[model samples]
Structure formats: C-alpha cells, structure tokens
Target: MTTNESIGDKFISHRMLSSFDINDELLQKLNTKGFTLKSEIQAVSDDTLRLMCNLSDEQLNTINELIRKSHKTIINHLTVSHIRKLSGNRIHTSLPSLDIALGGGLEVSKVTQICGEGGVGKTQICMQLCITVQIPEQFGGLSSHALYIDTENNLRPERLQSMAAFCLESYPELKQRYCAESMVSNVHLFSCNTNSRDLFELIMSRIEHFLDHHQEVRLVIIDSIANLFRYDYKGNEFQREYEISQMGHKIKSIAHRKRVAFLISNQVTYIPVEGKDTPALGKLWQTYCSTSFLIKRYGEYRKTYTLKSVNIETDRHFFFQITKNGIKEVLPDEVVDAIINNNKL
Candidate 1:
C-alpha cells in the first residue's frame, strides 16, 4: 500500500486517500458524502458514518487510525514562549483605555463574545472594529479586511461610513494609505436572512470559500449570533445546544487555521436564578469563547464589564458612549457626573 507521504499536515484530499489504499469507488463515495477535508471527516461521529456511508467495523477502524495519524502529524510541540510568539497579532479598538484594558486589543485566532441587551451598542462596537481593523499597521492596526455576518439586519452603511470618516480624520497621516471609502468597502457584509440552519450551513460551506478568496480578511464579525437561534429551536433545547456546539467548533477551527479573529455578539437573557440578565445560549456556548464582555446601558453612557476572560482580570469595567463618529470611551468622572445629572432630572 502506498503511504500518504506528501499529505503532511494538509487537508486530506481524494488523491491523499488513494495512498491509504482506499479504492476509487470508496473515494467517490466519500466525496459524494461530503467528507472532503480532514476536519470534515473528523467531525463526523462513528454512528453517523455507519449510517451514511455503510462502513464496516474494520474499515471504520482503518479510517479512524488514518485520521489520528494525520492529526498527530499536524500537532506541533512547542514551548510556552514559542507558542505565544506564534500567536496572531491584535486588532486595536481605536480607544486607548479599552485597548489597554484588553491587554492590547482584540486578539486574532480566538473567539471574543460581546454580550448585551438591545441597544447597548454591541453592533456599534463591531462596526468600529470593522473600520479599525483597516487602519494601517503603523497606526496599530491589522491592515486587513473584515467580514460582517449580519443576521439581524442591523448593519447600517451610513453608520459605517460615518465611523470610517471619523477614524480617518483622527489620523490624517493614515490618509496616505487609507481613505474612508476604501475602508468602508473593505468590510464585506453578508445578510443571513434564513433560520439558524441556514446560518450553520453558511458558516460550514460558504465561509471557507469566502475566506479563501479574501485572504486579506483578518477579522470575521458575526453581529448577534443569538438572533438566529432566538426564534428557531423553540423548545428543542438539546438540538439547539448541539447545533451551537458544532457551529462554534467549525468557527474556532477556521479562526485558528486561517489566523483570523472572530467576534460574535450575543443577546442577554433574563436569568431568573440570578435575578438579572446574562449572556444567552447557556454555559455550553460560553465555554467556546476565549473572552466575553457584558455591556449595560446606564443613562447616556454604556458600561462594559469583562464577564470572563483567559488573559484579563474579570470584573474590570469601562464606560463609553455612542457618538456620530463611533464608540468613544467615557471617563470615570464623566460617568459619575452623568449619573448625578440623571438623578436630578
């Protein structure tokens, strides 16, 4: 049997399967079943494989061993420092205090969740990041494109245009390399009007192709991932959670493999036990995020607290307001004064 010597750490293709002594008929069957990539095959369960492809026990064992070997070859053993050095770069938020609190800015190759109630500026922050990611590297930016997956029909082009204009105006020198029009254009927006199933399919099937063609896209923003799941899966909690886990796994895989950042916005649900609102989708979904921020509206200013994070201290909070330009950080004194004024009124 020929070995898959040339398939070192890359996606398992039909040609590579030939090296495993998989016959042409079996290869065609796998293709028809959509088990094209190693990740796709690995994601499938043994039961599903048996039902879908009619693979016997021995054949299943062989395929599983082949995948394990391929995965082993893909794993890199490195020191802690080496791994940190290899991590993706950050994308600044354009706010000094917020960036400092984030230990730099939004990190690539990780999922960051922004959770908040309606009109708490979750989309505003996402829109700001879309523009900020386009800023030149000299200005502490990723200098790349951003993919905005709008599921709630909340993305406003006028808002993006205004934010981009202000971002450019803040740094006149950036005009040499960037303009408001170009920055706005770099943000690729997709409206997923269908149900949660459609969203899942979009992420699993279309996203990889989109990213392939737009290699410059370093950030992928799914504004309000909770929206898709809100109306769908009304009572089937188990199925809803299962689909969420699968979608999140695919998202994390793409983020790490492509070296891109993923920012997913989540809705807040009133937790009866806590007697307050919490990020929706339950704990299962929360485990997938590397960092999470909970935003609350207080008078004219909005407060964002670090609900959970791997790199930053929890309970750390900051205040910001939404202006025509975009999200601007509000100082502590300003927050206090605003509260006092609102009390007087």
Candidate 2:
C-alpha cells in the first residue's frame, strides 16, 4: 500500500526502469506482482532518472538539496559504472610532461591517492600536475584551471612560477595564460590546520562559493589526508574510523559530483612485519582510493614510483621514478621484466 510496504526484492525493481524491459509481458508481470512504480517516478525529469533509480527518496532529496546549494556537489553519481566512466575521462593539468607518466593524465573524476615516505617528491609531483594541467594540449598538457587545498605549507608562489616558465620555453604563446603570477592566481589555495573542524568547513565553503558563482572548477588536490585525521579527529577509535570512512566516500562523491579530477597526497609510515616490507596505510586506505601510487627511492638519485593499483587491475603493481624536472618512465627492462613476469619479485 505504501513505499516501504513493498520492501522486498520486488520493491527494488521500482527504482530502476532500466532493470526491466518495456515489453507487455514484463509490464503485465510488474502490474500483477504489485511492483508498479515509485512515487517519484512521475516527477523524474530526464536528468534525474539515474538519480531516482539509484537512490531512495531520502538519499535523492538529501543529495539533490546539496546540489541545489553547491555547484560542484550538484552532479549525480548513482551507478558504479557511471562513476568509472567519469574517472576514465581526460584531465588537463599544469604539468604537461608529467602527463606522460599518468597514462595520458591524472584521472579527471577519480580519487588518485599518492602515498610516499617523506622527502620523496610527492608534493613536487602534485605541484607539477597543477602546472601541467593548465598548459595547452599541444605541449602534452591540458590547459585547465586547478584548485589546491594545502593542509601543509608546501605551496610556494615562486616554485609555481619556475614551473610555469619552464612550460613557456616551448609554448611561447602560453606566456599570457601561464604568466607566473597570473597562473598561480588561477590556482586557488586554501590553508587550514589539519585537525580542526574548520578545515572541513573551509573546504565546503570554497565549493559552495564556487557553486554560488557557477565557477568552472575542474581539478582538486588535497596535499595530505592523514594530517586531517591526525589533527581534527578526536580519535575515539570507533568514531574516528567511521568518520574517516565517511570522509573517503564523501571525497569520492565530490569528485563525481563536480566531474573534476581529485588527487590527494598521502603520507606513508613503516608497517611492521616479520618478513617483507609492508604498505603504510594498508588495506583500509587502499579501498578508498580508485588509483593508488607508491613512490620509492630506486637508484641513488633516480627515485621511482609506480601505479600499484588502478581501476583496470586493482592489484596490478608497476614501478617508475622521479627526475630533476618531473616523473620519468622506467618501464620494467627486459631482464627485470623477465624476473617479475616469472613471479620473481
């Protein structure tokens, strides 16, 4: 009689029209089974069909209100397949050269978690990406704007200027767009203490402000997620875990909602194990990241990092390194590939 009354697997069918064929037989079955339609079906505008199908009225109304209030949060992400399609799209960054290492570019609508020990160029890679995405496509970078939320004091105007100048050496016409001060200006930077509730508030405020003005925001980078948990969380163990898990889901939602590439840098610490080396954040953190990259010191100076897991292969681990300028491709050589492919490493 009511929405919740038909609450078994039959009720689930009302949510998605795509789940049912439009045949007379299926329609007759649906009618006979009392699996008719959700109340919201009548109000389902073309744009909101996916939203309606994927969420209950409660979830849809809550997220719909969020979109109405904020521009970046307004986009919809109902299905895992839809989310993956969004993440697979192109991303323009300030670092054109570095795009080569990212298999085209950093994921546009996915959360890319870059984890590394201290002094391993994680910040630098992020900065380079900021620079690379803003350069024109001709130079191997997508010319687009970026947002950098700095929980750490890693952002420097002078450094961004140098990278922009390097980008201009080849693309002289890019001077107007990549002007050191101007380009840096395009990069919206927000500094907030790690543990403060105001940090999350500040982030939300920026998104709301941008949405208010319908600002075009395509890329978002959070310098370090660990710092946020370390400082802001009261660490009640259970509560902290729940909060972190919720935050991870929210971050992923924002990336999809905004249709913007989200890259978050993470700090790594030694995980004690009796035998082999262990990852810092381990399995829990890995679950939140659509793409997880690990940066390790390979040669004396040739620090290599690799895509440990991506959507394609959640467990595929590859390796590469950093150079004086940016990320370098060090594909597994013949001998090394043989050893690895042969299950040696």
Candidate 3:
C-alpha cells in the first residue's frame, strides 16, 4: 500500500542501511522489494541512466519511465550531446549558413578541408569560421575557440578585424557579447615562415598548449599544405609521391586525435590524362585526401569556381563563386542547368 513518494521517503529516511548492517534478512527484504546487485560498477553507473538500482518490477518500470521523461524534457528544451571533451559546442564561421551545411554545425572534431587555387578565399573562409565558432551557442554557434596555423601569407590582423566588423553589422548582439571583448582572444594563430620539420614542431607545440588551455578547440586550419610539400621535396616525382602521402596520413591522424575540424588548403596543377589535360593535385595528394575539391579561376570573371569531385554518385558538377567574402555554395542543379543552356555555342 506504500505510495511511490512514501517509498522514496522511507528509503531516504532509512538509517537501517547503516545501523542494521549487511545481513541475510536485509538482503532478502531488498531482493523481495526488487533491489538487484549491479554487476559492473563502472559501466552502467557512467551511462545516461544516472541512477539505477534494484527495485521491484513495478518500481523499476516507474524509474525507467521517469528517466525517459527526463530525457524527453532535455531534448525538448533543445539540449543535445556535447562534443566529447569539448568545453562547448558553438562554432563560429565567416558564413553562418555554411555551418548549417556541415551537419552538427561544425566543430565536431573532424577534418574538413577547404582547398582552392591561389586567392580563392580558402584562408578567408577559415578565419571567418574561427570568428563564428567563438560566438556563444545562444547566438547560433558552437561557442568554442579556434586555432589557425597559417603557413602562407594569409595571417592579417587587419583583415580579421574587418571581417569581425562585418559580422558585427549583421548581428549586433553577437558583436556585443563576443566581439566587444575581442572573441578573437579565443583564436590563436601560428604564422611561422617555416616548412617540414620546423613547421610540424611549431604546430605540435601550439596544439598542445591550445588543447591544454582550452577545453575545446572547434577548428584548426592549416593554410596551404602545399607549402610544406613544395619546400620539403625537390620536385622529384618518386620522392614527392611518398612524402605527400605521408603528410596526408599524418594530418588526418592529427585531426582525428585532436577531434577538432581541420581545413587544409592544397595546391593544384595540370596533369595530362590519356590524351586530355585534367586539373588535379597530383596522384598521391588525391589518393591521400578523403575529400577533394578542385578550384580554378573562371576565365576573367575575377571569381574562382569549385568542383566537389569526391564522393559523387553521378557526374554532376558544383560551382561557387569566390568573392572577397568567402566560399559560398552554389546549388548544383540551377548552376549546371544554366551553364548548359547558356553555352549552347
């Protein structure tokens, strides 16, 4: 006849657990009432079910229902899983919608390369993402910091300042909350003019410091992986093949280990395939990268177009203009259709 509340109160109020001590009688009563011994103390205790104990079948069902309801409430309130070992989950980017395109809105500890030819807004995109990632979750971001490893001539304070100013104009509150105190504080940049061993060592040191200091680093961008490749090897085809592959493997491993998104830019060159010419980043580079994007200037349009060549089921091409702003995704269907219709000549 004991109500759930009454039972909880009885259990909570019972000092018998301490006074009576462990005995056959106590164990019998507990077992009869539905208290079972948990086998693995570490495994089940650490799970989403914060507390689960042996109880009568009815009581167990009630507790399970309560836990389910609690989970539903949390989900309804829009709280989701936090990134593992990440301080927070708001990632800022130059383009807000770009984050949306990336499932979980970026900052989930995966390598996301943004490759393009020279002056195609690769570094700019990375910088913008850094700025956006530092903004709080309430403002629609991962609410995490960024670390930028600039291997080229792309680290410009004034440029970042200008980008921040632009973001401020769009979202005044975000500017007030994050940018007013310089959210860029959360962003650490390594702009060393070194290559290969020196570059790797510098990055390794900085990465350690960032991981130690910041609980979460949403993004790490290595601008132009080509720099290290060109500098390390003397353009010997055989040497280049092995070296680039090794570089890619190491980069991929680093990204996986750190669990931060990596966006590495690469150089492109024209190679003869069969009887025709194709633009690519050599054989090793292509083989090593999980995703490959080909970017080239669209004639004299002063804009660069990007081709997402990896992971396509059909022979469909995607094009996006590279502006002073950043890499924007152009819908494949609309652009391709327009190109075909207009270029009937």
Q: Which prediction has the highest lDDT against the true structure?
A: 1
Estimate candidate 2's RMSD in Å: 11.9
**Cα RMSD to the true fold for all candidates:** 8.0, 11.9, 15.9
Give lDDT per model, in order: 0.77, 0.56, 0.51
For 1-345, candidate 3 gives per-residue lDDT tens digits of: 334333232222211221223445444544332232221111123332223334455544444454445434433433112212232253544443344333335544344555556775667667777776666676655667678787886877766766666667768777546563385566787775576666656554556566667667767777876777665767676666645544554554455455566666776554546652233346545433333444444432222232322122212334454445444555545555556656521
Model 1 scores a TM of 0.76
Off by over 4 Å in 3: 1-107, 138-140, 203-206, 235-243, 274-288, 299-345
Of 1 and 2, the candidate ahead on TM-score is: 1
For model 1, how does the per-residue alpha-carbon lDDT over 96-165 read when each residue is reduced to its tens digit?
Answer: 7667655578888777899999888999999999998888777777889999999989899888999988
Q: Estimate each model's TM-score.
A: 0.76, 0.63, 0.58
Query: Native-vs-model 2 lDDT?
Result: 0.56
Name the best candidate (by TM-score): 1
By TM-score: ranked, best first: 1, 2, 3
Which model is ahead, 1 or 3, in terms of TM-score?
A: 1
**C-alpha RMSD between model 1 and the true structure:** 8.0
On a 0 to 1 TM-score scale, where does candidate 3 land against the true structure?
0.58
